[model samples]
Target chain A: MKTARVIYEDGKHKWIALVRDPNRPDYLIDSNEYLVIDDDDSLLLDPGGNEVFPAVFSALSTEFDPRKITKLFASHQDPDIISSLALWLEFNPQVKCYISWLWASFVPHFGGNKETFISIPDGGMDIMIGSQRLQAIPAHYLHSSGNFHLYDPKAKILFSGDVGAALLPPGEDDLFFEDFDRHIRHAEGFHRRWMGSDKAKRDWCQRVSQLDIEMMCPQHGAIYRGDQVRRFIDWFSHLEVGIVKG
Target chain B: MATVTQDTGRELRRIVRTNEEIKRVVATAFKINLMAMNAIFLAKRAGQTALGFGVLSNELRRFAMDLQKQMSQLREMTYGSVNTVTALVKQARLNRVLERARKESSGSGRSLIDEFMRTRHNLVFARHREQIAALNRRLSQMIADTAQLVELGSVLARSAKIEAAYGGAFSTSLMQVSSDFERTIGEIQRSLESLTKHQDATL
Candidate 1:
């Protein structure tokens, strides 16, 4: 079974994290899925892969109608990020997916036809959920060539995709980290190897540092909140990435 | 309750798999329409010598058209089943998750979970199961109807084979065409039978 926690809630608008599945197999890496509900419309971010669909969908159904989820935001095209595309579309054919224009043709192989996807350009764009606006900020090559992070201005939450993801050890099910140094130790190796470019890292850090983010959510492991958000950005800026150990 | 959830999941998976098999069968059935056209052409070439064969071929063509129409309907119904079963599978999964959550929680949390489960049982899970049963019933009925139509085609095919014997000089060609019709119709019947078995297992 998986658990969903409300990370942020302001009236009808809320950010729910579908986090932690104790039943998940050891070989499979655990990932986080976020649901942004703004009034009647909702968007699911990094909806995870096919293997986790049952757990994610079941966890989500406890709080919201999985079918009524109007939009899907794929931060990048990693299987862990959005491989469950077909299963999600199966339940709601009307729901549209937001991925980079680079993957518009590629992602359909998972499921869906032409009318199913709304292509987000290289520069990114504003995605609307009811009356609220969520910006798709470009964070290309941080891990994937065509990557983007979602930012809800009103919620002050940045869904950083894999940018701040940590490969925490087993049973580390905390939703948010209290100590930056302790958490960064888990994230360090992931960023060093997964994040391929120092320039792209600097670019992401510089741009993200400008935002007034209260919560920086990653696809994997715990989230960065308050001052830890800044601490992560600073740590990532100086870190060397894309190491060739061999 | 866990067993029910597991059974529902297994049944939904079978429905999806059966639906895919039916689609492939339907695609194979489309070739019957083309074979019917070839039979018509062969009947025309035989002229007055094969007048009886000509009439039987025309009837076979009509049967092909009717079968195609029924197949289109069956295809549409199976697609509806796919969509419904997909949703049902999700609900069953939700039931499992809620069950696990209930086991883990206590006190106020457990009561809250109980309330949520009651709502799901009444408003969602039960209704979905009923909906799926209704859809499966309709699918079974459709498959049966299509099978009856294929049996009629089989009769026409056998009749055409007898008529081909009287075609004089064109006997060999007409005989070949009638044999092709029998084989094609037989293939369709086997596929429909497979579909019926699948639907039965699911139900």
Candidate 2:
């Protein structure tokens, strides 16, 4: 539902990161990303299989060559998060796979018989695209152990895979919409309905609040703006505490 | 989170809802039957005290059997459909057999056909109309009670966050409404007996 595209660099090549579906939205394609830099190293963040591959390529735009992508980073084990990793890795022969060691157990499930990708160390990892650096913020308990949110710190944007996601209408490619309250409701509804455990909700909320969120490009639903941020947090607090009103 | 809580809350409401419905049918039959029975018991007593047992008592006692049959059927029906209607219809047949027996039992008493018809007219025509009206009133109350139950179910089903004090109040209110149903059945039975006695005397 929510996708983000931004240009970041001290100089040289411009970078575009596309955040695809996080939560199971209109499409089951799952969330992924494409980090497009100029003539050098193009990267993919969590390539989802089947339906999402086309979506990731389409969002990458014609300027970025699918085959020229030099790095593929899979944040977690979920088939939705990394099922298409091997497929994309096959296409780009020169690409290095940046697979998480904590989540490496998921490779077998994704039909990746070989452990070829380099590991992104726990706590944090940094990737350089020209002069700009992309930080992998640790996101644990976000469904599974091997998960991290990609933060474009300079752009003040958090690609919160499932943490801030909300399922929306299918084939909807809106990165951010004006009516963000509707998106907030969608996220709130999904949090309690699909994701179980009060402890989990509290943990996710705690982890996400630390980031200086500007454009909240979630995996699903419309992008929420500044005002909707506090509203969603307050709403989650009430649900977690079980304080029902008339 | 709310949905899980709402589902359990809805189930509790359903129990009260079903209990409320069963309450009405039981109450209605209870009223009609208790009235018809009283009519026979009192009617025969009147005939025995005023006239003699030979002519009126024996005739009226035969009428008591009809009332007894209907009462028996009404009792059976309280648990389920049972034989409430079939037994009532069978009473008509029993009346014929009993009528012949009464004639044999009393040599020159009045024709039981006339007695039976008159007794029926007193119950079905003169008394039952008013009893049925009262029954309808109780039925109306049952409707309102169930509507309240459904409203309670829907409200409780929506969210799991209402205060325990509010839930306790709602439960208490529903229980009170439930007790009223039983109390109403007793009241209806009392009212029907008053009328059934009048018709029961003539036969």
Candidate 3:
């Protein structure tokens, strides 16, 4: 079964992370799906692939109406990021997908039409959920060439997408990291290879460092809180990515 | 039970594929509507010499409008099927997960899975299946309606061709317009035939 944890909650606005399913097969990579609820309106971030749709849908249905998910934020066009799009749209035909303009055409192959997507430009834009304004911060080349991370100023949460994603081994399913060093170990190899550019990493680090964030949520692994958020930014800045060894 | 799952899976794939095909048909229908307008314009340019052609062209234009309206309705109906079939597929995947969970659990955990399977899972699955069945029936009806509309378009195209032969000095231009009508209507007919085949396979 998947676990849904409320990472941040303030009155009607809440951030719920549907994390870690033990029943998932060993081969399928585990992913985290975030639901940002503002009153009756909600947005689901990187809703995962088709394979994990049942788990994610059932988990979210327990707390929120999957039909009420008015918007979807795809960090990039990876299968694990937005492949469940068709299924989500199936459940709620009115849901509009917010993806980078670069992927507006390509991502629809997973399922959707012209009216279904709200394309965010390369410079990024503000997306409103109820009265709350969430910024789509451009984090291109951290992994996918056309990628953006979502930041909520009021909640001080930066949904980092694949930027801080870690491939944790079996039975290591804590929602938030207790040890920064141990957590960094799980994330190190992923950052070195999956993240394709040194310059992009530096730019992303500099831009996000200015933000007042309490929790940095990633798609694949545990969330970084408080001091670990800064520590992750620093670690990611120095990391030599796009490694092609002979 | 496995056969039912496989059949549902096939039906889901057919729904998605047919939806895409319907989009193409709708585009073609829009084009036919435009072509009909162009034919009326050309018939006016041909003057009194093409009076018979003008009247037939007007009828063809009306036929095109009716076809476009029907195609739009058919497209709208497919959305419901697409939504329901997609939900059915999701439920199937959940069933697999629940079965896996059941094998790994004991006592209360197993009982919980059993209860969910007996109640929520089964109930939701049956509901979705029924929705899909109803949508399929409606889809079949719409396809038949569209096929009949396409047949009417064919007759209008044939009559327009005969009328074009009486255009005297405007005969060549009128013939070209009539040919375009025939070709476009043929395309719509083929699309309908493909939809019928897919609908039959799905059923």
Candidate 4:
């Protein structure tokens, strides 16, 4: 059974990530689900779609009793990112999902009522988990038109959603990338095709570079920790995204 | 699949009912202590003539006290089991809902379909099922202990009856108290036996 692994923790605050299931079928793209626990409340980020609900739900149960999850954050309206909205809402209707105001109406088509969402304006907003504040940084058109990345100032950990994701090869199932140069090859093709604009990628890299981030976490592949955080930013800054290369 | 869910729901309800029954047994156990205390006082009134009966009454009082402590432990365990069952029921319901949704869905929404099937194979329900199994094991052990308590009470009751025969002026009253203790213990034994059997089938 897939269990939650605590990726980061300090006192009452902790970041738990449910890793990709090894037995997951070849056709489906692997995704990671994260739980940010602060005191008594927890916020689930990019909790994945309905298909992975049982796994996600089961992984979450290991760390949290069902009621501990008070909120959810969807990076964009991707089915892989938030399609499990309806299933999660079923488990916890009171859980408020944070998403861009643009997808406020569109994402609910997946599964949400008027009261279920907390719409972040174009500039983005600060979300409170218990007493701790987490900033939602805008990543518009990196892929989705109105996407966001979560930043925890206390942990200096940035949950970049699909921003740093890599499609890892089989047998190399490590959680954190030990070598950044080797890891970028897996992420390069995904960023080129999926990220909609070079301008958006530049804007995101420039903005995130200024933050003192220790670890850059992606939804799909291994995390970039320590100096690799800077290496990823520098590499993404020069990369030509959204272009059809021969 | 629906049948499995229905059976699970029914089993959860049965667990809840069993917890309530165990609570009632604990209350009856409290009453047994009261009866044992009264028997102690009746023996005291017969003075030196009922000294042997008095000794047996003291032993009965200690037995009742020990049984009460064990019953409290059993009640605590039962309450914990109820909570575990409630968690299992929640997981079971989610699984049933996901299965139904998967069948009803189709099309270019291939990711969504994959997600439903993915969740079905995930470890969440399996973990809860494991927890529920552990709870059943603890409950079985608790019920087994209650059975042992009943056997000990029966032996003590027989000893009290033999002592009551030598109680002189308080002989009749002492004999009556011993018989009452024996009957109460029998009722407790029957209730615990029924509980164990009920739990056995569910486990």
Candidate 5:
């Protein structure tokens, strides 16, 4: 049987959670927190953006222990992503919170206790869990104040924040895209509305292109696979760098 | 002109989506500035404000106003002329013809406008430098005044013969306030330098 896709619907909690930089509208960004259960160590990616004590906590409790949550990962230091970090750390004292080096000060700024943080500057860390290895490819500040993307190389799963995540229609709840065009529209609308720096996003797309992606786990919208990710990147590459282009 | 049109068109395209983005950032920064100014005012009203040099609150109030007056002069220089990035870009583009002339001609040391702009820029920089230096001087005077005020307050606090031991206490307190005020000024200067640099770069 296919693995269960545990989802935490943002509903209205996702406002300008990912706002395109005022200077650039083509690059989509905003801090997003997601967790993936990959058989071994429960990998939490960008965990502090949304209030996790209830939604994310209940979602993750299905597979693992909140106390056994050894790894807490984040892309950057925006409050949505890092503010509620203290709340996350309260459940597990041993959870080694990880964030990008560029926003190390950002953690402390959010009252994240200095003792619990581990700095990871660049991407490409083959961090091994029980059996699966997560290849964290660096996705820098494209739209948010600070940002990154985490990928599970083995599962071909890309945990991309604010990338392809779009507001689902009234009653729809499918995370995976069946049609490529539909997914592109969902992704593009958000990107155009809340993008960051085009140059930075172009660099990010180029960097992640090396990875063989199958499923994209975006923070806001549904997931995409294979060629759709490339298509999104292509369309995104043409958008304005800092300002919105009509 | 065609190239300019193309570039401007590209910039206009970039502007559309950034409407939301720009508004939000500008709003946030404005909010922070307002908050900081309000906090400063609230502290002053509460009488919880600490002077740079241990001066009485009223004297320091005057000092702050004086410093503000001096800082306003800085704005005159900053927004006086087109010293922004857009202006610089336009200048560079216009200077291309003059640059070619300099390369081809035997006697093309500098054009009249070139010399004139250079002099004008020097004047701007000189004015800015004076204002910055004058601000620092005013702060120094403020600290001195504060120190004297603190010493006077301390003397009033003492009883009997306020002559012998008071001198020693006054000297120490004076030094402390003066040093603290100077350090505060240094920090202010550093913050201003960085903010001004960012303003210039972004513009």
Candidate 6:
């Protein structure tokens, strides 16, 4: 029982996030799937693993005709990010998958073909959803060596992928972060262990700091909205990442 | 400058055809099971004169039902494999589009490609392609199971025909019918075996 909620909306151009499934197995890691709908076109970001496909697919179908999901964005080649690809292709084989050019050849192992991909350059580029432009910003080495985040300039929302993803404790399933300090505690260990490169983290923080982002949506845990978004960037900038003490 | 590859379209069509064939095989197996049940009912009406035929019919029906279950499993695996292929082909095409754009965009697209090619040749493609190959092993198992069912059906048919010949003078028609039943079952088995072979090779 997964639920899709409209997290950001401006008429036909909207951002919908599909969150927690009560029926999902406890052994598997939880994930949040985002759908950016612009008029008739829709792009699904980090749709998630094969095990969660049935729930994600059913939930997506309920919101809109799943067939309208014209594009897919994989921040990196992780199975949890793109493994449900084969199942999604079963619904519409022609849906193109957007990924970093680095994992262009690699991600297919999870499921996808050449035509099904739209490779984002290492620097990232603007992807068109109907007439609207969605920027694929470079967030490389946040966790994956070849990662990019989706940014909607019109909505001023940055889909940070795993950069701000937090693996929250049980019984905390809020959609947006109300307590920034408390949420950062859950994310600190993840960033330290998974961020991998201090230089990459600094580079990403500096670049994104320049943007007029109102909301920071991650692939897991609560989203950061308004002033919390600015606070998150400032906190992340000064923090030393990728050095594991334990 | 990204030209669509002909290989993907052809491969997708092949998957569609393969799924259709799997459905037909399962449907045919169910029909054979029904015929086997009818034969058992006729043998029952004939009483002790055709007791052997009744037992053989029951065995044939059981085998047919089992084959039907196996065929259903095969169908499921085929759908899974085909879906995997569909995704692979689609992704490949999208990769080509980006590669083409990178080549044509002068230095603009080169940044993405250059950085991406930095730590290259991970062979994730080969790993994913193995999933499709695994489906062939699944098909092979189905073929082996069907071969065993066919052999058992043949043995039962021969035994039933011999038993029919021991009938009374009024049982001549029953003997002839038993032989015809054996031939029909043999023909059906041969046809199914041919189908399996064709599928095994194509898949």
Q: Candidates ranked by lDDT, best first? A: 3, 1, 4, 6, 2, 5
Q: DockQ numbers for every candidate?
A: 0.05, 0.00, 0.04, 0.02, 0.01, 0.02
Q: Best TM-score goes to which candidate?
A: 1
- Give the Å shift of residue A120 in candidate 1: 13
Model 4 chain A lowest lDDT segment of ten: A59-68
Task: Give stretches of model 6 more than 4 Å off.
Answer: B1-203
Candidate 4 local lDDT, A100-151, one digit each (tens): 9999999888767899889999788999997899999999997899999999
Candidate 5: count the clashes: 20
Question: Tens digit of lDDT per residue, candidate 1, span B133-181?
Answer: 8988998998999889999999999999999999999999999999998
Collision pairs in model 3: none
lDDT of 6 by residue, B85-195 (tens): 776675555455335423433332355344432322134335445776677677667767766776777787677678767555525755665566567556656656665
Best lDDT among the predictions, by candidate number: 3
Give me the displacement of residue A130 in model 4, in angstroms: 1.2
* DockQ top scorer: 1
lDDT of 1 by residue, A16-87 (tens): 999898888889999999999988899999998877876787778778866588789999888898888876
| Tens digits of lDDT, candidate 6, A111-196 | 66888888889989999987789999999998998999988889999999888889998887688768889989988888878888
Q: Candidate 4 has which clashing residue pairs, if any? A: A49-A84, A50-A84, A51-B115, A51-B116, A52-B115, A58-B124
User: lDDT tens digits, residues B1-203, model 5?
Assistant: 24543543443333222233323323333333333343334334434222322223234344444444444443333332213323433333433433332332222223432453365446533464454345434433433443344334233223111221222434443344433333444444444444334333323
The TM-score between candidate 1 and the true structure equals 0.62
* lDDT values, one for every candidate: 0.85, 0.49, 0.86, 0.82, 0.49, 0.76
State each model's C-alpha RMSD to the native.
7.2, 29.0, 10.2, 18.4, 25.3, 16.8
Give the residue spans of candidate 4 off by over 4 A: B2-203
Docking class of 6: incorrect
User: How far does residue A2 in candidate 6 sit from its true spot (Å)?
Assistant: 0.9
lDDT, candidate 5, A1-246, per-residue tens: 011234431321111111111221223233234565544466677664323333344434433445566777776666556565654554455677777767776676544566777777575465655566676667665566456777766567677766666765533445456777765665566677666666677888787777788667776656666777777667777755455657
lDDT of 2 by residue, A1-246 (tens): 224466354344554655653433443544536463634665566666544554454455334545467776666676676665644544444566666677655575554445456677767688765455777776665545666767666666666666667765555546566665556655665665544556756776776677776655555555556766655656765674322334
Query: In candidate 5, how many Å is residue B149 off?
Result: 26
Q: Lowest-lDDT window of 10 residues in candidate 4 chain B? A: B102-111
